[model samples]
Target: MASKLILLEGVPCTGKTSGARFVASQLRGWHKNVRLFTQESPTNPVDLMNYAFLTPEQYREFPEEDRVLFPVEETENPKGYMIPLTELHESLQKELESYRFYGCQPWEVERPLMLARWRAFAKEAMESDAVWVLDGMFFQNPVCEMMMWFDLPQAEIESFMSELADIIRPLEPLIIYLESDQIERRLREVADQHDYEWLDSLIAFHTGQSAKPNEVPDLEGCVLCLEARQLVEKKLMSKLGLDRVILKNAFTDWVEAYNFIRARVYEKTMGKPSTDK
Candidate 1:
């Protein structure tokens, strides 16, 4: 069967968002039902970026009126009932932000919760004809959590990703990795483009981890960390046992990149080469 899932992954400044959108557009042109889910998209099926996960006990403690105000999704995990943290009013969000899953939970708790979502998504996706263009779900966000937030060992990270690969294997998902040749220069470019505050926050996020002495003290350190991350991501991509392509980050010629990706995605889903000119 043809693949329904297309995953775009890379380190920062690698244009994953654009790649995802382009892939979705190309698939749509082919008359496929495409759903593009960027990394920050709140409606991403396989990831809960701004959602809060609460145990049954914690959820029950919420005021009865509040419980009925917003939507919540029940999960197989006894502890994981999800509510939208961003959708709630500011005051209410403040009260529950601590329960947010991404940065708030430890890896031990987060690993299963995240995998469960992937499993469910894979199963449900098989039932639909809609093609899903997902940016960052396969590697970027998960790697960030495992490496920076939790300081997990490399083996654990690989294991977690391996399990995800297995769950989605039936879909024969196509993985597109944007490869960056100039890590430091690209990071500096990103820093220059964004506000100092954003860069500062990112630096803090990388340095303020379990490791000591602020290893990622500045932009240079950030670049090093990203380089290391790219190595691991490439390693995983090489051995994922799935159909994939590594596209060099095309800063100067996005039209070329878009064409290349579109052709790859088309071949994967159509079970043959694309004849687009």
Candidate 2:
């Protein structure tokens, strides 16, 4: 049983994955149940939308069907999420794939189906008794990816975020934003740590600077795209107006960050001040 939805979001190497694992363990230590969802984890039933975009590894295997367009990660039945795309209404299949990927705007044909999917996710998560820890679903997936793909304006981003906020309000998510003080140092570290040979793909995916994956784009372009994205994310996060904890230098100060979140979750779940505080 999940009591709350805690979404972890930040730039690369900002301890999102590590901190998510840490927080989940902390919750468990408190005699609370928690479920962790991350991209690196096995495919979930609701993973349809996430795999719509190619990961770094999947991009390297490009020209494969459904890489960028209508991407689908193979998954066995009885998935952890327990909600399969096959169960969706037959009419929504085509648009569901596009909407899952944010392929169209909210006012377009995919709007209703897209909103339905968001509602479905939030509803299920809200009803769960365990605290669910998810990386990137609330903020990163739609905000950054859609902005980079469509070159959307701030107004458009704000509106879309508003709709999303309203849909998930029932779950009462506490967003733990993993931020870094030394942005450039962290950027370089993430790039180097992965032994990344897919700079062009990374750049193109994040910024939409290249038309196709084959085109080699310079690092400068990617840096600029990253910088621009940071601003947009900051604005959108503020607009989201959910319960938030911004952990500056989260990479080094994760213990403090985790303690803060532990208190918040305890308060929400127990409906009182946490003994942790």
Candidate 3:
């Protein structure tokens, strides 16, 4: 039997990567294998290349019915709109067409086929003793289980999610929302610390003005904004029937939040140390 796979999903800068790493480190201490996968990592150039093949024009020209190849649009209340991609017929058809071209389409190029691929990957990862921690805008991919982070402003989260809804919605991964005060804070931090000149240049090249800290292209699979972590916790528990979800602080206090999640993950994956100790 394969070990359980726990996925930590959230918007950019929601501490998904950092939190996953911390959790993985703790898991390793217990002799468990863990693999951290991020959409932004350069190691997975194949994934990037595949994404790059779909030019902006191709993306825009993709029939609305084919939009299942894309990510899910972010909604003000993501939990309320957790519909699976299989339900979007037009979008699924387009995705099958793309799959056929890639030669990765199985015997049945349908929604169930696509979903099966995800399950297979998760299962394979687990068999290898790897707990896959995926950090990306995966709001569209429907999985049997998921943990979505709902920590951002409503307008901002929606804006980011709209951009990727066209390419990643088919995977149907479960969501893990993180609650935060202002989504922009995370974006600004990344831009400030990392080289976001490309984004600025792109905006200036088009709009003839340096893109403001908050003005950038939307990421895929983001959804929802909550006033507090409690609201998010209540919604996930009620909607998914999961009693507890790992809730971390906003980007500003990411380090502390990371530690908290790490500790919880350790306890869950490995029982507390023996009292004899």
Candidate 4:
């Protein structure tokens, strides 16, 4: 089978990570080369502090460029090169207080630069021989050769849909939307993990924004919900669709999800066992 690029897009708090993991496990079981990349970096407080320095309205109105980078300064310290001392100090205090809780060094506060780094990473992944399973809120960008949209409730996505559309347009890959109920349940399940509080907040905020009507752009690809997976199969019969893609119920336990994916892999590989074993 030809190499496939699967992008799983969803608001924060939605179960994209779990779903992506399931997909990756299934692909590996089928003996297809697969690599799963999820966004795991912590948000830098310096970046947030700088942005927050502006008046709330001003911050909201600031040009994307201004919001992304600091102004250049002639001093050797450089204007934007280092995180603001005050912000860094405050962040350090928080890190020290929550050192055990945080479990990682605080992220350096920088904007678009980090995003650029991630883009480079994705480019490298695309160049590899393995099937790529990217899970995140990567709005449809030119960098993405193919795309998938996880449809969730408008209440769940809030403003993120608009923000995402502004960066990327008309993705040219299969778009899969988990029904709203499933998406919500997944978020709740993730929130149950005590250590995932930050992730939970991020998801809740985004999902709330996505709920706004007309926020999400019209994407160019197949749209599948939890129930629609069956329909997708019927629609793609005889076509070289995502043979690697599998349908999973939102309510199903993780084990069932694993089995569902494994079954699809078995079908695709004609019962060939995964070589990884």
Stretches of candidate 2 above 4 Å error? 1-3, 45-113, 198-201, 209-217
What residue runs in model 1 are displaced by over 4 Å at the alpha carbon?
209-216
> TM-score for all predictions?
0.90, 0.71, 0.49, 0.39
lDDT of 3 by residue, 170-234 (tens): 32222344545455555456667876774464234223354544443331112122122234333
Expressed as tens digits, the lDDT of each residue in 154-182 for candidate 2 is 88778887898888777777788877656
Give a tens-digit lDDT track for model 1, residues 103-211.
8877777888888889899988998989888998888778888987888888888899999999999988999988888876776677677755666666666656333
lDDT of each model, Cα atoms only? Answer: 0.82, 0.62, 0.41, 0.38
Give the 10-residue window scoring lowest on summed lDDT in candidate 3: 140-149
Runs of candidate 3 with Cα error greater than 4 angstroms are 1-3, 42-113, 137-177, 197-237, 242-248, 273-277
Q: At residue 32, what lDDT does model 2 achieve?
A: 74
Better-scoring candidate (lDDT), 1 or 3: 1
What's the C-alpha lDDT at position 173 in model 3? 28
Alpha-carbon deviation at 189 in model 3, angstroms: 2.8
Ranking by lDDT: 1, 2, 3, 4
Estimate the TM-score for candidate 2: 0.71
Q: Of 1 and 2, which scores higher on lDDT?
A: 1
Best model number under TM-score: 1
Say which prediction, candidate 1 or candidate 4, comes out ahead on TM-score. 1
How much lDDT does candidate 3 score? 0.41
